[model samples]
Target chain A: MANNLNTRKAKQKTLTVLKFVFLFIYLVVVMFPFLWMLTTSFKPSSEINGPVDYIPNNPTMENYINMLVKGNFGKYMLNSLISSTFAAAVATFCGILAGYVISRFNFRMKTPVYLLFMITQMIPSFIMLAPLYQMLSKAGMTNSLGTLAILYANMTIPFSVVTMSGFYAGVSNSIEEAAWIDGCGYVRALFSVIVPLLLPGIAATAIFAFMNSWNELFMAVMFVDMDKFKTITVGLNSLILKYNIKWGEMAAGTVLALVPTMFLFGFAQKYMIEGLTAGSVKG
Target chain B: MKSNKRLGQRRNIFIFCMLLPAILLPLIFTYYPLIKGGVMAFQNYTLMDIKNVSWCGFDNFANILSNEAGVDFGQIAKNTVIWVVVSLALQFTLGFALSLMLKKKFKGAGLYQGLIFFPYAVSGFLIGIMWRWMFNGSNGVINDLLMNLGLIETNVGWLAQKETALLSCMIANVWYGIPFFTIMITAALRGVAPELYEAADMDGASKIQQFFNVTVPSIKSVLLMTVLMRVIWIFNFPDLIYSMTSGGPANSSQIITSYMMTLVYSMDYGKASAVGLMVIAFLAIFTLVYMGATKYTSED
Candidate 1:
């Protein structure tokens, strides 16, 4: 009996070690491309097409300098920042109001309204590409960053409403009811008491909206034709479309483009994960 | 009672005001365009001749379907099927495996999870750019790595060759998508009760047996929902393909959505709209059929 127990324990230890090894390998696979991009971004133009160096022989900041200066990437970043921020704000505000109504009110159109949002979320954004292009162009709204921001807000609203509705459902109605007893109107209670309580949830939803707008390539590529109004994705994509692709500058541009979303993920990873998994886990 | 009635009227107004923007934006942006696109699908809506826009019913659809417009819709349909099925299979299997390993806490598991899940935050376009370079015909990391590993003696033109182009994109997609499943399934796995495993153990069930009988059954709903959401998402995603290949080398890597993108790029709005309508219709039908099938199965 003692011998058998020892063998089983040894087998368990081996299995555990194997699992760790497997996990470690996957982690490397997951990270290798990003690491490669980083290292490539640091390498000089000459070293890029040469033997692949896991670590650059002599890392330099020239790529970054070139991307920011010669590549017009700063303009792209600014456009992205302004548009995404606007999109996030508008989306969050509308999402909160709609979510609050859906969660709290006993309206006649509640289910239908909620279903409208849900079904729209399932519909692909590209399906509207042609008509939107026509409408915006007819209105002379193409190439306008502000217009792009509004379109993005429209793009993210369905998701924002759905997610915010989930968050609102989690908060108790009693807090608002108490406020109502204190003579607070529904809107007043929502903005004052409930909004403060759901700040983290609001942040999560806004971050998601911001990232969606920031990362949107199709709309930006279609709508924004002018160089000055281009977002980061469009900027990077144009570089790829150019003949004789510049590897170093492209890598640098990609790295610069990723900073905001990656930083947001690091800062608010918890809320983002919670925002994503909360709905499916419960439902 | 009169005061209460007045208050109720005020509350209803407030609610309507609150919901107006959310409802109105979609109505203006999504619904209006949906209707316009539906109309444009049957019209000669080319950007080249916007003034001559007149109804041309079924011509765009017929041309695309019968290979009249050089689109090879049959190949595109096949490519889309291959793309969705292959990418979904690999992403789900690999992601599920990683989640299973990461579900139970181990030393440094959190950091590993964070690092592995980092790609989920990276945009699809960026992932495409990274992979496009990595899979470059010459001077690519994939080629270098393969040579080093003794897997291939010569460099392969991953994105240039018709055979490997779609496959290369699929690899990048798999890489980008694995993190989503990991994040989702890990959460679902954690929600599974420990007592179920214990009961299975007491019944002398093997580890694999317990996994299949207990853990899988416990997370079945989450799994189904996640898979459904992912299928729609993957089908909608054309960003990576557009960035990486642009359906290049005689349209070898062209899926239905990417082909629509090419039409959009060429300013063939009528054809693009037709394809868009087709996509929406297909997805609607697919969603209904999938939900029906899953609901039927689950009833047992």
Candidate 2:
């Protein structure tokens, strides 16, 4: 009996060690590209070629300065920020209403409304590209950041609605009922009572929507033709197209583009994970 | 009592008003374009000559299907299949393995999870550029590493050659996809009941057997759904391919979606719309069949 127990302990220890080893290797594999990009971004143009060093020997901010000044990456960054923020904010606003109704109310058209929202999540955004471009061009809205924001909001709304509804479903209605009994209107109760409770959910939905718009490439590329109006992704593509081989500048630009999402992810990792899982798991 | 009933009706109207933008925006932006795309597929539409846009029944589809435009629709379809299947298979396997590893909590797990999941938030376009630079034949990090390790004497033109361009793009895609699988499978694993594992252990089931019986069955629905969703996403994902190769090296790396992008770029709206419609129809059919199969199996 003692021998068996000893063997079991030994086996458990081995398994634990194996797990750590596996995790370490996984971390290296996952982080290598980002680390390489960081190092390469700092390297001077001359040192970017030939044998690569894991660490930059003479790191300089020239690449970054060039990207901001000559490459006009600052303008692209501003464009992305405006579009993503606007889209995420508007989508979340619409999502809160739709999600609340779906979760808290039952109406004659509830089933169809719910199904419509769900079906929207399944369709690819690319299918809407050609026609959306056509429609926006007809309205003379093409090549504008406002049009991109509207399209992005449309892309993000379905997922945000689903996520917000999931979060709302978890909150009990007793608080809202009490608010109502105390003479608060539904809107008042929602803002003063339910909104506070759903802050984390709201954050999650907004982050998801923001990330969607920020990272989206296809729609931005299709809609925006002018360099001044281009978002980060499209602007980067233009840079690559114009300059055949500028690795340092490209790396710097890529790293700059990643900063906002990375910071957002770092701060709100829990909410983002919760939101993503909630969205997918419920489906 | 009558006033209360009227107030209730007012509240319903208020709720409907609140929901108006949610419903109408999708109808206008999403469904409208979809319908327009369908209509445009049957017409000889060109952005350059919008005044001459007229009905051209089945011609656009035939043009692609018959390889009339030199786009080689048949090869593109084959490449699309290969791209989706290979990427999905590798991603799902790697993701599942990573999830299983991450199932049990350990030191620094949070940090590791953050790093792993970070790639998912990065734009596919940026990822393509990063990988393209790394795969450059003359002065790429990959070649430097390989040469230093004495693996190959010469630098490989990963994205320059027809034989390796698609594979090179697939590697970047796989890297980008790993996190998705890990995030999803890990979440699903968390939902698995602990009691099932204990019960399996008590029944003298081995670790492998317990995993197959308890873990797989519990996360089956999530696994199926994520896989199906990924398949559709991958089919429609053109950013990485567009940025990396632009379906170049003689269009060997071009998948159907990127081909559609190329068509759009060349102002062939008719062909682009037709391709878009075909992709939508294929996804609809695929989703139906996949969901039906899963439902049938679950019943068993």
Candidate 3:
């Protein structure tokens, strides 16, 4: 018995060590690109095309300055921010309303409406691109940030609804009922009581919507042609298409564009997991 | 009794009002465009000559399928299959393994989880650009590292060649996608009961056996759903391919969706819409079959 236990312990130790080694390697593979991007962003134009240097010897902010001033990245960043914020706000609000109704109320059209939203999740935005472009161009709405925001909101609505509904499902209705007994109206009770409780879930859903809008390249590239209207994705993409690719400035712009999403990810990671798993596994 | 009836009617009105924006958005944005695109698919609706637009009666579809279009439809179909299958299989397998390892709590697990899941937040286009530079023929980190490791003596033009362009994009797709499965499977794994594992252990089952029996069955629904969702998303995803290769080097990297994108760029709305319809048809069929298979298996 003693010998068996000793061998088992040794085996467990080896397994633990092996697991760590595997995880470490995976981590390196996953993070190496970001690290490389980071290092490359700080390097001067000369060092970027010169011998492969893992780290920048003279880490300068010249690339960032050039990208901001010359590349119109600042304008692109602003456009991205305005559009994504509007998209997130619209999506989250509509999601909250739709999610609440679906979760709390069962009207005659309940199942059909739910299925409609679910089916939309399967439809790729690419399919709608041609017609949407035509419609926007005909209406002279192409190259407009407001138009872009609306499109982004529309794109995010289905997933946002599903996610918010998952969250609403998790919250018991008893609390809302109790608030109602205390003379809180439905809208007021939702705003004051349930909304507070679902704040994290709402944050997660909004962050997701924001990230989707921010990252969208296809629509931004297609619907908007003007330099002033371009998003960060379009700007960075155009930089690559130039005859002489500016690797340093391209890397800097990418790093800069990643900041908001990365910052949001740090805060909303737990909520996002809950929201996504709840949306998928439960639904 | 009359007042109560009135109250119920009022509540119904409120509900309807709450759902109006949700209903209107999808109707206008999704269904209307879908219908319009469907019509445009059969018409000679190229943006270059909208005044001459007329119904072409499947001409666009025929041209594409018959290789009359500039792109090779057959090669594109094959590329799409390889891209989806290889990327999906590797991502699923590796992601599942990573999730299993991360299941048990250990020192610095949170930090490790954060680092691994970081890619999920990054944009697909940005990932493509990052990988594009990394796979650059000259002065790329990949070539540099490979040479240092003595794996290859000279630099290889990954994106410049038709053979390797799609493969390189697939590599990026795999890397970008693994985190999604990890995030999802890890969440599902947490919901599995420890008692089931204990029972399997008591039965003298090996770890692998226990995993197959207890863990698999418990998380099967989540697994099935995640895979289905991922499949749809991957089918839709052309951003990476677009930014990485732009479906270039003789259109070797072009998937069906990205092909549609190129058509849109050329202002060939008719052909683009036709290709878009093909994507929808493919996805619809795939989803139906997937659902049927999963349902049949679950029933069994």
Candidate 4:
């Protein structure tokens, strides 16, 4: 019995040690690229191509300063902010109302409407991209950020609605029914009861919609040529495109562009995971 | 009955009022452009001739098929297939392993998840640019490492070589996509009930057996859905590849989306539109077939 107990304890210790070792390797593989990008961003441009030394002997802010001075980094940052915020706000508002209607009322197209929204999301985003450019040009709004916001809103609303529907589904209808019995209308009950409950979903959808618009490089690169109108993703992409090869400055720009997105994700990660798992796990 | 019908009609109108923005947005943006774009596939249109276009019914398709449009689309189609199947299969496998390993009661799981999902937030174009920096022929981290490790005697041009350009591009894609599948399947794995595992454990099933018999069956729905969606996504665009290689090394990595962009390069939207239509049609047929098969089999 003593031998058996000793062997069991030894096996348990071995398993624990094995698990820790594998976890360390997993962490290294996952974090290496991002941390490399961070380290490379700080290193002097001269040392960028040197030996396999991960750390720079001398670091400088020359690349960041050069990028800011030589390029439209500030302007593009503002452009992305304006475009992404506008898209997120409008899309979330539309999604809230539509979700409320879906959750509250029964209509002929209730099931079909939900399915349609899902299908719209499933279709290749680029399938209509080329034609949309022409359509935008026809409307004489290809270069306008206002028009970009409208397009982004359309692209994100289906996702927003699907997510909002889930949020509403989770929040019981009993409270809203109580509101209705208390002489409230559909819109009133939604505003007073359901809206507060769906805050996390709205927050998640808003962050995602913002990310979608902010990170939209293809359309911006294709459509908007005017420097003043272009967003950050397009601007950085064009910087790389027009100039074939510049490692340090491009890395600097990419790093700068990625900062805000990481901050937003850091804030809304819990909600985003909940939204993702709850929505797609059933599929 | 008429009064009740009128009241019901009023509620229906109210619901429609709420749904107007949802309906109108996709109609104008998605449906209208889809039709307009379909028409472009039939016309000889250019960015310059948007206002003044001439119809060229099936010419683009026929010309592409016959190799008359200077596209040699047969080659692009082949490259596209090679790219989609290889990278997608690898991504699936990597994603599966990551999900399974992470699904087990391991420490640092949250940190692993956060790090993995970080890549997905970076724009596709920026991802290409990031990889380009890593694959820089003269001064890349990868080359430096390989040399230091004595794996290579000299610097090897990664993106410039035809043999490795597609694979290099695939490396970037796999890195970007691994997170999406991991997060999705990890969540799916969590939904697997403990009782099934307990039952398997009681039967003296090994850990590996429990995985195959319990875990796989539990997440099959998520697996199938993600596979379809990921294929649809990866198959459609060459934007990421374009940002990386631009179908370089004598068009060795040319896919349909990259081919489309090349048309824009040559100012030949007429042909690009046809390829675009083919892509959409292919997806449409796939959806129909998959849904048909599901309905037929599920009756059992």
Highest TM-score against the true fold, candidate: 3
lDDT of 3 at A36: 93
Off by more than 4 A, model 4: A1-20, A49-52, A103-105, A122-127, B1-7, B48-52, B104-108, B293-300
B4-71, model 4: which lDDT tens digit per residue? 99978877887998988877888898878777777888988777676778898999899888889776
Tens-place lDDT digits, model 2, residues A97-128: 88888889878898888778867776656557
Q: CA shift at A86, candidate 4, in angstroms?
A: 0.2
Tens-place lDDT digits, model 1, residues A1-283: 9999999999999988998889878878887888888999999987887877888999999999998998789999999999999999999999999988887889888878988887787776766888898899989999999999999999899889888887888888899999999998787898999999989989989998999899888899989999999999999988999989999889999999888888887777777788788777876
Off by over 4 Å in 1: B1-11, B296-300
Task: Name the Cα RMSD for model 4.
Answer: 2.7
As for lDDT, the candidate ahead, 2 or 4, is 2
Question: What DockQ values do the models have?
Answer: 0.66, 0.60, 0.66, 0.52
Worst 10 residues of 1 chain B by lDDT: B291-300
Clashing pairs in 2: none
The lowest-lDDT stretch of 10 consecutive residues in candidate 1 chain A is: A118-127
Tell me the deviation in Å of residue A144 in model 2. 2.4
Report the lDDT tens digits of candidate 3 across residue range A132-179: 887888899998999999999988998888889899999999999999
lDDT of 1 at A40: 92
Q: What CAPRI grade goes to candidate 2? A: medium
Ranked candidates, highest lDDT first? 3, 1, 2, 4
TM-score: model 1 vs. ground truth = 0.96
Q: iRMSD per model? A: 2.4, 2.6, 2.2, 2.9
Tens digit per residue, CA lDDT, model 1, B1-300 = 999999889878988999999999889988999888889889988889988999988999999999999878999999899889999999999999988888889877766776788888878888999999999888899999999999999989999999989999999999999999999999999998889888998999999999899988888888888788888888878879988998877888888888888888888988988898888889889888988988823222
Model 4 alpha-carbon miss at residue A109, Å = 2.1
Ranking by TM-score: 3, 1, 2, 4
